[model samples]
Target: MRIQTILALTDFSSPAEQALERAALLAAHHQARLQLLYIAERQEAKFCDPQARLEQRARQLSRRHQLTVQALPAAGDALAALHAAAAQADLLVMDNRLHGRWRWPTRALGLLARMLRTSPCPVLVVQGAARAPYVHVLVHAAGDEDSGGRLLHGAAAMHAGATVELFHVARPRRGLGLACGEAFARALRSRRQRVQQLAQPLQSVPHTRLRVSDAFETRRNRVGLATRGLDPARQLLVQQQGTRADLLVLAHAPRGVLRDLLQAGKAWRLLAGPEPVGCDVLLMPQRGPVTARPEAAGDAPARQSAVARRWTQAT
Candidate 1:
């Protein structure tokens, strides 16, 4: 999506700081306005001036990134404030509570997953160490086709030339006592259609020397989730291990792929597993059309040139 405004929520912790840095870099990359929000607990607000602290932090980031940084400081409920602020932003960047070192009252993953389910805008969950630009992106394309496609296109815009692996798991073919041949043929046709639908967008991204390749590769595997009783999340992790991506994208909705995955708490398992994910996880909510910012008539060339130069130098 055209990210004109990015909102970042922080509690001033280490994980929050890392998320802020990522938000800043993304804001600079897209030439978008960066808004920093800090919500003070009622007790803390009574003791300290949260607005002052927020303004001070905003000024620092603005100078550091050479971009306008808006400071939004509020007291009381944090999630309530976050939801209100998110309405005006194209994307919300925040620290996944699961990554926090300290113990929290609520399960961080559950909270974040709920936010992912309800947030009006896309949310990027930053985990692990900072990687300035993601070079390898692994996308779990198990949800709606439109949502999955938008997530990929938006990612391509952010990290030009990164190798994107579109991974999906199809339900394993079940035995049909009667009409076995017809059943298999129908299943095969369905699988083929799903692959084409997911791959259609990437095929159109033009290749250029100045930018990263928009061309993406797809991997589809069949698992007998129902009959074999396999874990969808574990299976996904196994595939992700093989790809070794720098980022993982998931389009979460109540029903469909996410329901199957998250119902088993797979999202939490993926992030809080013993082995580190070793990449950033971006969770996007399924919504209407996701389009890039509409540029001025003459701005396209300049923007493209700037993006090309950045990627060229980075590479």
Candidate 2:
């Protein structure tokens, strides 16, 4: 994907500073324009000139990095302001810890999760220090092949020299003894074979630097009826620790029932865990080629055209 504009939102915290530095690195790498956005708290606004300071920082960054930087400062609801500003951006970069919290049952949701839900483009949640030009990137493929392809494309676009590993979690079947784990392992292997086959042409054709390696680990709940609804997030966290990845890419909720469950449960847990994850996270939206189902024939043409447009740009 061609990234033309990157929007970096900041609350002026240490994490936000790291995000800004990372954003500058990305902008310099992709030759993309940079937009620095800050939403002022009521008390801070009363005491300081946020817009002027924001513009000053922008100018400083522009001069220091020799790249275009635009500073946008706004007051009131931060989420609303960010949503409005991110409309034209290809990537939204922000801190992992921000205002608001996720409320599942209620209408209110955490600012980060809520932004991921509605963002027009992919959202990159940057945590920890400013680690530029990621050396080791990991893309969690899970069960979605399309999402995996998109993740690989994204990784290639962002860091051409980074060692990219596509990791998959295979959940073993229950009540089948050793056979359950073996079966899941075989299935994961088959999936990896298919992914490799699909990627062969991509490596030769356009994404030459997007070569990706693959790995899978089996995760099964403890043997018991009480463990019926085991959480996958914990296992995922464990696997991430093993990889020690610099960047983790994941797809957001898709339309299918299984995907929705994964997103609503495991994905939510991962994002809302008690402790922060080690690496940066990129939450990709659900986007793919339109299906050929006859019931949706009316909209198929438009969807196909849109896909074509995207493919053209990627080419």
Candidate 3:
């Protein structure tokens, strides 16, 4: 998989700056275009000149690598500015926290999560400097043959810098104990691998790691996942040992009944305000391969439905 372009938003803080570095490295590795931007908040104008700051940051970023930076200037909400810029980007990169403030890291991550739902591209959350790009990528795709393959491709494309792993959580009809988590994972891996080749060629490469994980914990041979309804594997991105990922990519399967349920629940969870993830989520519609799905589009359809209801209510 090739990364055609990368978009990194910076607040001039250390964490944000580190995110820029990661973006630069990925862009350089893939020989893709890099766009570095800084949005100056109107109300908070210590470094208020958006154009000037953008230009300065762009120059600094360019010096660090052999690339041209696109500077964006916007008034009003800083988050809005970054969201607009992300409109044309393939992947959105930013830090989990801002510099100097010592604020909780999740504060910036929350905004990134909302932006992810609406972003046309996948979002990458860089939390401090980590040892790996992505050792194990967690996937939430479940379907027959065609339904889940598209999401797997998305995982590889977005995580071109790291190895790709396939993870699928199938809820038991009766509950949880009866399900075969390992066997299910193997089958999904076989199907997905047939659709797309792992980055490693000829044989597996130590330079990169790619494998599939089931909801079951490999350690105890027993399930770490909840028995049925609440296995985090079906919902949240839980931190796993020896399998940390620099980014998390998810493809929304609109047609699959199971995926649709999970996605709807996920949207409601985000809308209620704040989630427990420190990583960025790239929520793309399962329209097909290589097509970008932004969250703003989802809002339009939902908002239209609400308007239709209000009209019905007035009558």
List all candidate RMSDs to the true structure.
13.2, 10.8, 12.6
Candidate 2: pairs in clash: 101-110, 102-110
Candidate 1: give the clashing pairs.
Answer: 2-292, 2-293, 161-212, 161-213
lDDT scores in order: 0.61, 0.63, 0.53
Q: Per-residue lDDT for 127-234 in model 3, tens only?
A: 656433554555554541345355566665544435655555434422223244544544555456553443234134334445666555442223333333435433
* Candidate that would win on TM-score: 2
Estimate the TM-score of every prediction.
0.68, 0.72, 0.63
User: Global CA lDDT of candidate 1, please?
Assistant: 0.61
* Residue 277 local lDDT, model 3: 47
The ten-residue window of minimal lDDT in model 1 covers 208-217
Evaluate candidate 2 by giving its C-alpha RMSD to the native, one decimal. Answer: 10.8
Kindly give the stretch of ten consecutive residues in candidate 3 with the minimal lDDT sum. 98-107
Stretches of candidate 2 above 4 Å error? 40-47, 73-80, 98-108, 172-185, 188-193, 197-230, 254-268, 288-315
lDDT of 2 at 198: 47
